[model samples]
Target: MRVVIALDSFKGSIGAAAACAALAQGWLAERPADEVLLRPMADGGEGTLDAVAAALPEARRMPVTVTGPAGRPVEASWLLLPDGTGVVELASTSGIELLAGELRPWDASTRGFGEAIAAALDGGARRLVLGIGSSASTDGGVGVLSALGLRFFGADGAPIPDGGRGLPEIVRTDAGSLRLPPSGGVTVLTDVRNPLLGPTGAAAVYGPQKGVRDVARAEAGLARVAEEAPQIDPSTPGAGAAGGTGFALLAWGARLVPGADEVAALVGLDASIAEASLVITGEGSFDPQSSAGKVPGFVREAAERAGIPAAIVAGRITGDADVSGFAAALSLSELAGSPAASLADPTRWLRAAGARLAAYRTQDE
Candidate 1:
């Protein structure tokens, strides 16, 4: 029998690679003869670069220092796939976690992410995969465009400052200096499907979590950009991803793709699942939202199509979580007897969950 453990990062607990390893460790302890395969995975968020890098050892890391979300210089790296495809993760460069205790929802920028993309393009990558989850900005990706050589000039002809605070300044954009990845262009991975400017847009939907008191102000900032740049569709689904970073990339001729699906394809998920007797996948939490471009949903759909059993092991499962498609569902919170206990150490709980699931055989097998 063969088993495949592919899961998204457990967020604060551990990365996708470590989670898979822990699960594999427990499963193999029970059945040593079982050919266990571990595939670290992500849905285009914080661990995207690490996930892809772990899966493809052939990928080379391209490290560079760039401006961070808060206007400070920070070190960052992107991955160059063996096939000349570049993987750029916004969370790595401009994610909310970088700020730690100093949340700057109003002013954090995406400049660092764009710089990493530029580095990959300069290194001869023909196609680009841009991940825009876990942002710390509400600048409608103005700083990203600025880093990529698109200048924003105010009505007085001076360049605006580098954050949402500067967005209200009447502006004109110059994109002539922008260099695109060969003809392959860019595919942006977005975790959300919200529009660029609205009540449920970037600011209103995600600002408070990032520590903002004025969602309306952030929404207005993006609105100004929409007025100035009619070519950029403000109403497109996923335009609100990463505080309008998705909208910015779309304006630059990139296609918006669901992050989980995009990553699964990049990591050759189906090919691995094809030979697996059991498939295990999950994330920090399994809820109604997991059906929306999350790793678990992707795994269940793939496993069902391949006629294999798929199980979910997560930190917690909300009451509304739909698990009808999975063969088995395990929640660390329930196994550990409390949410705090599970959150405290999901890696251990995940191992126990894996061992329990190993007892069940794939229905199709």
Candidate 2:
């Protein structure tokens, strides 16, 4: 049987590619001569660089010194595509994963994200594709602006401290000293469809995930920023991603596109799925969010068009999941010998799950 193992990273446990490898290993053990293809996927959030790099060998990793989510010094990497296009993932610098439990969104900043972009520009990149998601801040990208030489002055004309809490104090924005590569273009890749402000805005929908407890206060602060800032559409798809980093990039002339679509096209995933008899795709969890431009849903749709059976294997599955488009949906937790205990050792569970899946191929009647 020709099987394609396309899966997303298991968040805190293993990367997408590693999961695929584990699955492939089990399948190979069951069917030694079976043709298996492994393709790792991401939602334009974390692990995006690794996914694209795996597909495009010509892409080079460029390291840059930038601030972490908490303003600490760190080294982050961005991809330099062969065609002078740079692929930078904001999660590398401003991701929530980098922050300890004590830090909050009110104090985090996207300044490091901007620094990475500048570094990419300095490296002779003419176009930049910024994957924005899993951000630790809700600063409306003001921190990024500050890094790019745009001064965010308070009512007293003094520069405010970095973060979303400081957004309410901004009285003016100076962009005269901002520097940009002579011939560079910027595009923002995101998975969210929330707006920059209002109930479904970045702060309202994502602030709590970044450690904010007072949603009302955070929403009010963000609303003020929206009122004071220059005109920028926040309602556009993906604009609210990365804590409004998409809106900020849009303000700076970055084209926003669906994260999965961009990555799929770049990796030629459609063609690969077309050639497979069975396409298996999944993520850490399955929910309504998976339907919102995520990889598994996209792969399922593509597989359906090609008359290929698509199956999903997730760590856990919830909600009224629409499996009509897929051949089957399997939750690793359900098949795990010890579901509760397996959460701590996902690698074992994933391998066990893979073996269980392979067993299905052995049953004749």
Candidate 3:
């Protein structure tokens, strides 16, 4: 049997590439003679850079230091595509994972993300594609703008305090300080459709996730920023991703595109699906968001177009899931004793799940 192992990261447990590797190892144990293909996938969020790098052997890793989510120094990684394009995932330096519970949205910033972009520019990259998701802040890119030389002033013309809560105090913005590399073109990949302000805006939809309790306050602050800045079409898909990072990128003249399609095209995922007998794809969780141009949904569609059966193995499955295009949808917990136990021991569960999946093949065939 020919099997293609394509999976996303299990979030805090394992990376997409490592999950695929574990699955492959388990499958090999059960079906030593079968042909197996490994593919790591992402939804244009945290692991996008690694996913693209895995598929494209020509990509090179570039190391850089940037400010962390809390304004501390942190080392981050980005990929340099062969075409002189830099691939960066904002989460590497500004993701919620970097913060402890005590550090809430009001204290987070995207300054590190800006520094990463600056580093990419200094590294001779003329084109930059930033994957915006899983951000730790709701500053609507104020910190990033600040890092890029944009200055925000209060009513008295003094510099405003840092953080999303301070956005409402901005009286003026000086974009003259904003500088880019000589010829760098910027693109942003996102996975949400929230707008820049109002009910469906970034603050309203994602602020809570980042620890904003006073929704109205945060929304008002973002609205003020929007008034001073150019209007962004929040209706655009992925506009709401990364706590309005998409909107920020738009303000910075960065092209916003759907994450899945961009990553799929970059990794030649469609072609791989077409050539595979069975395609396996998954992520940490499968929900309505998965249908919003995420990796698994995209892979399932591609597999359908290729007349191939696609299976899914996820960390958790919730809310009456509907994986219509997939042949089978199994959670790692289903093979393990319990969901909580599987989450606690993902590697063991993943290996067992792989073995069970491989056992489905018929020897007579």
Candidate 4:
């Protein structure tokens, strides 16, 4: 039997590629004769670039140095596909992880992300695939827009600083030197659906995660951007992604699409599932939200559509998650005896989880 193992990153613990490899190793250990295929997956998040690179061997990495979330230089790379499509993941450029656990809610900027995009455009990429997830700032994407040649000025007609702290002082924007979108236009990939402002908006919903103690102040910053950019619809779904980076991309004429479904198509996941007798997909935490535009849920649905049995192996399966869709559900936390143990050595537990799933298949047969 052919088994396919595809998983998203286990958040900060392990990346998708490494997780897939470990799972495949354990599966083969349990059934050496069985063919196992490993396909890493991501939903417009930190592991997106790895997923694309793994699926498309023709994708080339174009490395560049850019400003990090903490305003320091960091090495980042974008993927350039053979079809002239540039793939940029915001997590690698301006993500919270870049701060190394030090949150810079009001100071971190997405300017590095925009710089990477600008580099891709200069490389002759005819189109773009932007993944906005795990952002570190709540600046309403002003930093990104500034990097793309859109200037923001205060009422005093002077340029404001970068990050959320400068958001409230913006009075007007000048797009005189702004870069135009590619002929094929831009496609923004995101799993989030929050708007750019208000209670459920970027600041109120995600600012705290980025270390923002003053949610009200952050909301005011985003509100100011909404007030200034009346031409761009702040209420658009996913506008809050990456701290309103989605809204900025929309202003640049990019269309937002569901990251998981689009990535599945890009990586030909359905075709893989069709050829496999069993498919396994997972992530860090399998919760109620997993069914909503996340990798594991998308994989499960795809496998069901293909009439193939699907299994799940997550770091931890939340109590509220519905596991009825999967033939078998395993958690690394259970196998490792504790969440701390599971996180300390994810590779070991993931391997054990794979073996457990293989045993389940054997018993069912």
Best by lDDT: 4
In lDDT terms, how accurate is model 3?
0.79
How far out, in Å, is residue 33 in model 1? 0.6
Lowest lDDT sum, 10 consecutive residues, model 4, at 223-232
Candidate 3 regions off by >4 Å? 181-184
- CA lDDT, every prediction? 0.86, 0.79, 0.79, 0.91
Candidate 2 lDDT by residue in tens digits, 283-311:
88888778778888888877888889888
Clashing pairs in 1: none
Give all candidate RMSDs, comma-separated: 1.8, 2.1, 1.9, 1.1
Stretches off by above 4 angstroms in model 4 are none
Clashing pairs in 3: 192-238
Clashing pairs in 2: none
By TM-score, highest first, what's the ranking?
4, 1, 3, 2
Q: What's model 2's TM-score? A: 0.93
- lDDT by residue (197-279, candidate 1, tens digit) is 87888888887888868877777788988786688778899998988888888878889999988888888889999988889
Q: Give lDDT tens digits, candidate 3, residues 1-365.
A: 77888787888878888888888888889989888877788766778888888888999999988888887788898888998998888878888887865557786888898888877777878898888878998887887878888899998989886678788788888988797543667878777766777777788888987889998888777777667655666555555567767776777788887777788788877777776778888888888778667778878888888899888889887767787767777787767767788788888887877887777754324
Q: After superposition, how far is residue 257 of candidate 4 from its true place, in Å?
A: 1.1
Candidate 2 ranges beyond 4 A from true positions: 181-184, 227-229, 362-365
